[model samples]
Target: MQPRKDNAGFSIIELMISLAVLVIIAGMATANWQGTIERHQARQTKQELRTLFQVARHTAINRRQMTTFCPLDAANACTNDWDQPISVFIDPGSLKVLAQPDYLIRTFKAMPNGTLIASHSGPQERRYFQFNPDGTVHGTIGNLTWCPDSLMAERGVHVIVNFGGRIRWGKDRSGDGVVEKASGQPISCA
Candidate 1:
């Protein structure tokens, strides 16, 4: 009888090549996953802000009292730093300060990783949104822009609050990957 040769296992070179390909694929997948996570964080931040605005407006109208949505400082006074923990509270006095803990309707935690900028129609920085009992904004219209730490500023989303207290989201309308404001100008984070 003729002797038979065994070829039951892969060569060392073949195994090494397969491992290299797997490593490359894993690297690509990791990059894609990171991008997806960043997008999700941005989207979540936008939605949370929108919900807070709506809640503040509705609360003001229903309770027949002024409602303020803002980030509070150590003194419980409103601050322009939107990255701080935000609160929706009944401000019957329009003092922009949280007097009693019972007056707080909701408190939103700060963003995990990002920069939040709130600006009025002009060059003024928006410190807070005060909704009148009639559900209209008390001051100038403004927008809240959230920029992810990993992405460009223009890639972030915008939550605009009109004078009527209506909330809307602004996105890239020109397909240029940059969000625009009401004037069709690209949003500048700097």
Candidate 2:
């Protein structure tokens, strides 16, 4: 009788099964990672908008004056230029941020390829808004536009500041965070 020999290695079927399982696990991990990244971006974007709104409110209260956060065409008054960046400061009875020097109130870099469209009524608006000493947002002004550079592996974030000085973020066209709507409108102190 002839002796039979078997290879001391896994069969083709075993190799295929192992590869398939690894691929499945990898896919799941990728999906989870993507979700986490999106949520984080959304939160960050929300925070930035809130910070600006809060700062304006605090300025109005602390200085006992009205404040405005909006965009401009040139830098002047409290700002060195307009539409360049967001600004924050006191202007007579109005604390306005709308020029260079002043517009640099803060800075935030968007995630790669991620787009940020901010508007009081639309998503494609720019960074513009206002606040009163009584903690109310002015006009249909406050809007923020942002976009990521790409390669961030997530969805873009959006923020809006309505006439009530309420900053909100959102995934769709609706606002995010919280906007008091009726109760948030800016008001005079006297």
Candidate 3:
């Protein structure tokens, strides 16, 4: 212990241990960062949905015409699948997709992958939620739930509209500071 040797630098084992510790820390930080990213994406998607619905609702009120909200096909016809691109158009009192080109108001592209847009009438009949000229929802009052492909802890968001055409978000039933389905339950991927 008294003799001075050639102590130039750290030993190979010491260097490897230091590097291994750093890698572990990096891995943990990366995982956390990914979770944060997912949470942000979920929030943004929810906000987009809110804005779209509000626009559709307000359009009908201002124009004093039936406003139809539904997914549109390549031919611009209304499609039942909500996963496709959606658009708001003048209902023309027919409740069908308008034949006139100017009837088309706005179109939203398909949502990002790993996310889902679904609608249900009383939890069974899937239908489009239309707005009346008076701003009240046309006979279709239900929940439009948006969920990620993988239902992680972040869960999902629901834009709930009542018969009066009032739009509100699902409550934080889980009490996790994250809004979930309006049914007081966590959203399911299926």
Candidate 4:
């Protein structure tokens, strides 16, 4: 009888090629997953900031007092560093200082390490902003930009507050991946 051919298994080269394709697919999936995570984090940060501002404004109007929203240092004093944990408090004196813990209405934990929060309030850095008793911003309007320290800078978002204490989101009207400010300027991350 003639020798039978063994065609029951794949060749070594074929197995290797299959594995290579699987590796490539896995790499692509991992990259896409990371980008999705970064985008979600950025959006969550933006929402948190918007909620904080809204709470501050409503609190001021409901209590008929000024409500301040700002990041506090170890000394419980307002600081320009937006990365620190933020607090919303009733500041009758408008001193921008966390006088008593009881006055604090809410506190948001600091953002993730690779995340950044920058406030742009004209030339001078505004450590904090307060809502008047009438639910209007106490001073000049500004915006807070949230960015992730990754190659996907386009996933960043912005929370803008107008003079009337109305909070709105920055958009990418030009279909660009990066968000734009009120003036249609693209947001840049350092």
Candidate 5:
């Protein structure tokens, strides 16, 4: 009798188990990918804010012009999503409204994943934080808080651009000014 050959491959049951394992792996991979994207989006928002802050400060100092940073709304409020739009402009020499984009330095739209909201320490109507040619900002301690919609998050980000236009980011303890602290991030003018 000829030696019987055992044609063996993955049995149906073994194939099913392998498929299940693969599905689980794929699911986990997808979740991880989504998380990475979300975190990236958040970081991108903060980086953008930092960039704008530095650019505005430098432009004011270099151009010897008053650069203004403000929320898009005239009310100076960011009630929409976490990603809010903002405007930056240089004041016309005449001190009138920015001459229809002539003085517009940069216009930024918030990312969908993150919102940029503003809350002033003083008056509500005033939005613009004008920085003089000397890099001195003209505002009190105004606070802008950025956080995810979920409260379960342990840490949130805050941008405190003192009236002097000195920008720093840190944690927002109470989401208010009662007790805010910095996260030790390097925020330098140079």
Candidate 6:
């Protein structure tokens, strides 16, 4: 009687081939996931800024008083850095920097790591966002650039506040369906 050689289960070559295919698939999935995450984060940050501006504008109009938005320092005064906690408060009947807990209306936490906030205005102007009684921004009209970690892809957004205090987001430039800064190009990375 000839010895029986059972031909069952996968051979070594077949198992190796399947393992290679799985690795390839996983790598592709991971690459795509990163881009998707970057886009979502950039847009989310942009929306948050737009909402904050709206709050500032509405507060000024509803209270029939001036409202200010700026980065909060240890002393609760306005600072040039945007990475710090942002403060929205009543103007407190004075043009100087915001005082302590008394006038603060709301405080926004610091931004995520690798994210940067830049203003069109210089240090002096970026220190404060003044909303007038008519819901318009006081002084110069400028925009804030919400730049993400990497500029290699369309992973950044812009919050453009027109001179009338109308805040709008810059999204999907040229209808590419990708959220990015619409400065005619991707902004430079830090």
> Model 6 misses residue 51 by how many Å?
1.5
TM-score of each: 0.82, 0.57, 0.81, 0.89, 0.62, 0.78
Ten contiguous residues with the weakest lDDT in model 5: 181-190
Local error of candidate 6 at residue 143 (angstroms): 1.4
Q: Give one clash count per candidate, in the order shown.
A: 0, 36, 0, 0, 7, 0
lDDT of 5 by residue, 1-190 (tens): 9999896898999999999999999999997776666566657767877887888788888889877766555443322233446667787452424545577788777645544455544555345556788888754555555544431132235577765667876654454422254533422211
* lDDT of each residue in 8-78, candidate 4, tens digit only: 99899999999999999999999898888887888678778778888999999999998998999889998
Model 4 pairs whose backbones collide: none
lDDT, candidate 3, residue 53? Answer: 83
Per-model lDDT: 0.86, 0.52, 0.74, 0.84, 0.61, 0.73
Point out the worst 10-residue segment of candidate 2 by lDDT.
Answer: 181-190
Highest TM-score scorer: 4
Decoy 5 TM-score against native: 0.62
| Ordered list by TM-score, greatest first | 4, 1, 3, 6, 5, 2
Q: What would the per-residue lDDT of candidate 6 be over residues 1-190, giving only the tens digit for each residue?
A: 9999999899999999999999999999997987787778876777678778988899888888788988877766777788777788989564636755576778887665445566656545377788888998887776666656665435666676777889877666566544455365545445
Shift in Å, residue 179, candidate 5: 13
Name the top lDDT candidate: 1
lDDT tens digits, residues 1-190, model 1? Answer: 9999999998999999999999999999998887787788887887788788889999999999999989999999998888899999999889999999999999999976788888763666788889999999997788888888865765588878788999888878888878887777777766
lDDT of 2 by residue, 1-190 (tens): 8998988999999999999999999999998887676667656756765776688778767766666554433433333222244455554434443333553444333323344434333544434455666767655554454444332323444455566666665333224332222234321111
Give the alpha carbon lDDT tens digit for every residue of 1-190 in model 3.
6987889999999999999999999999998886776677778877778878888889999999889877877766666677787788888675566678798888877666445556655555354668888888887577776666556635566777888888788777667766676667766566
How much does candidate 3 score in TM-score? 0.81
The local distance difference test score of model 1 is 0.86
The residue pairs that clash in candidate 5, if any, are: 82-114, 82-115, 82-116, 83-114, 83-115, 137-164, 139-163
RMSD of each: 2.9, 8.4, 3.0, 2.1, 7.0, 3.2
| Range of the 10 consecutive residues with the lowest summed lDDT in candidate 4 | 112-121
Supply candidate 6's per-residue lDDT for 182: 39
Q: Which is the better candidate, 3 or 5, if ranked by lDDT?
A: 3
